[model samples]
Target: MLAVELNGDAVRAKNGSMVAYDGRMGFKRLTGGGEGLRGMVTRRVTGEHMTVMEVKGQGTCYFADRASNINLVRLGGEKLYVEASNLLCTEEGLRTGTTFTGLRGAAEGNGLFTTTVHGTGWAALMSDGPAVILRVAPGLPLTVDPGAYVAHTGELKQQFVSGVTWRTAIGEGSGEGVQLRFEGSGTVYVQPSERTTLGGQL
Candidate 1:
């Protein structure tokens, strides 16, 4: 469960995620994840669907979804790239949109576009377990399994790497056949457990 304290401020959260609240609070369903008509149209066209609600007023609100573990991320004028299903909540000042992720998204079975959040504020992400934060530097790159990926922050370049060979295709190779390679300066969030991704079945 995640607790958010609002003092005359508003926050955007996943619709139907609120479990409890105290004091005066208003919950309004946001059309198109609160990005307005263009954003709604973009989401529809990209296949990255997100249903959001705006929570406002002075009070503490609680949120939970499928009993998933929640991770809080503080952003200071940086962009966050995350899956729509993994994102839980964000401060009202943040801007939500979609970006092309190429083959990485296809490996996860989430399509070619992923959700993006920008601005200075806090956002919450959901994971199968407590998320692990990995740092990437100039020379030190990081590779992650598609099923365990949660979200990433900062400027990072991502590449889809396939270790699949003829042996793998014939079921005589390592299970770790595909991966997402990340380089540059950034931080990645991964879960301890892997989800049922297309890459995981390979």
Candidate 2:
């Protein structure tokens, strides 16, 4: 997993269980909280204990368990925006900016990251399993299966290549069918899993 901070230092959860610190003062939780959309809707639809927990800070924090190979880079003081497809569920509203899309089956305003963090900016991501950080030197340019590619910088343009198109047309998803080519020097994290899961933050 790659964890880069925009400003202050980010501490990992002591046990490192797909966790992150809200960078807040300690507050006792009276009860456990359910996360993601299910939890939020429950607040409105059922009027149950909708509120999960509270943090006493103004910065964004994140975490990813397992999928260890990582490449975290600071992008000034700005938050790196991502697609919900790229977003695993986050603490409450961290999945904002993930606009609605037809491919994923959501309509509108249905994700995380409602607000932006000011001083401290960072991107934390995980790999499906042990990953290989390939170096695209002069001769040996790295070409990986698209699924293996996780979060690369927005600067990288996506190129769709053919050779396995038939599989995806029928929804078979040829394991190595399509690949997003990164043509620059920015860091790209790749996990070992063929499924190449970016943990849905549920």
Candidate 3:
């Protein structure tokens, strides 16, 4: 099978559902249950319904039929999130967390979540994926703001560390150093260009 990609960034997702998506999204249609279906589905029957662009070379796809929007959040290093807003389905191998728990004072921005991959596996996010991917190696350092990351893979751990606040203070706000931190070795895929959700700004 090829890497999953959605023509548009959105499809529908249900409770207990999961799928990899790409590009921006439009309206998502639902089935018998709605948001209240989580108890019944347990994130199983949901994933993004792809548009035309993302499925150009792909076929035999998976889809989630309940979720509305999902975004790819970028944290520094190997950290990223399949943002709840833009998230369709995540694999059972990875871990997810709220972006606020780590730092209350700083790193307090909207449109960000925290996720980490434990082992080497594949996870898909909504985007046309940059034509090229950034390969992370020892001595090669990369830092992405919370709102800039898409998805990452390989052996890695995500920690909310002391960067969000310090970085925020640099501008003229309170000092709270809480950022989604990734420490380990891996690769991160980010689209130099991204699509903002409803507000149109990340």
Candidate 4:
């Protein structure tokens, strides 16, 4: 569960994520994740659908989804790339949109686009287990499993790597053949457990 304190300020959260609240609060569903008609149309076309609600009041509001563990991230003019299902909440001042991720998204079974959040604020990300933050530097690149990816911050380049060979195509190779390779400078949030992704067993 995530607790957010609001003092005349507002926040955008996943719809129906409010489990409890204290003091006076109002919840209004935001169409197309509050990006307006253009965003709605973009989401529909890209298949990155997100239903969000605005929570405004002077109290502490609690949010949770499927009892998943929450990770708090503070962004200072940086961008966060995450899957729509893993994002829980964000400050109202932040901007949210969808961006194409190409093969990486296809391998994760999350379609060809992913959600992007930017600006200086706080955002809550959900994962099956406690999230692990890994850093990617200039010389030190990071490779990750698509099923374990949660979100990432900073400037980084993501590449789809295939380890599948003739042996894997047959039956002698390891199940873990595809991977997401990250290079540059950024931090990646990964879950301890893997989700059921298209490349999980490939």
Query: Model 4 segments beyond 4 Å from truth?
Result: none
Q: Tell me how far candidate 3 lies from the true structure as C-alpha RMSD in angstroms.
A: 10.6
Count steric clashes of candidate 4.
Answer: 0
TM-scores, all candidates, are: 0.98, 0.43, 0.38, 0.98
As a TM-score, model 4 comes out at 0.98
Mind sharing the TM-score for model 1?
Answer: 0.98
User: 1-202, model 1: which lDDT tens digit per residue?
Assistant: 9999999999999999999999899999999999989999999999999999999999899999999999999999999999999999999889999999999999999999999999999999999999999999999999999999999998899998898889887987677788999999999999999888888866
* Minimal lDDT window, size 10, model 4: 167-176
Candidate 4 achieves a global lDDT of: 0.95
Error of 1 at 72 (Å): 0.5
- TM-score: which is higher, 2 or 4? 4
lDDT of 3 by residue, 1-202 (tens): 1233444233233233435434443333343213234422433333221111112222334454343233333333344434343344433233333332233112333323233322223344554433235666665555543344556654545554443344454674332233345556776655555343321221
What C-alpha lDDT do the candidate models reach, one value each? 0.94, 0.38, 0.38, 0.95
lDDT tens digits, residue span 107-188, model 4? 9999999999999999999999999999999999999999999999988999988888898778866778889999999999
The alpha-carbon RMSD values of the candidates against the true structure, listed in the order shown, are 0.7, 9.5, 10.6, 0.7
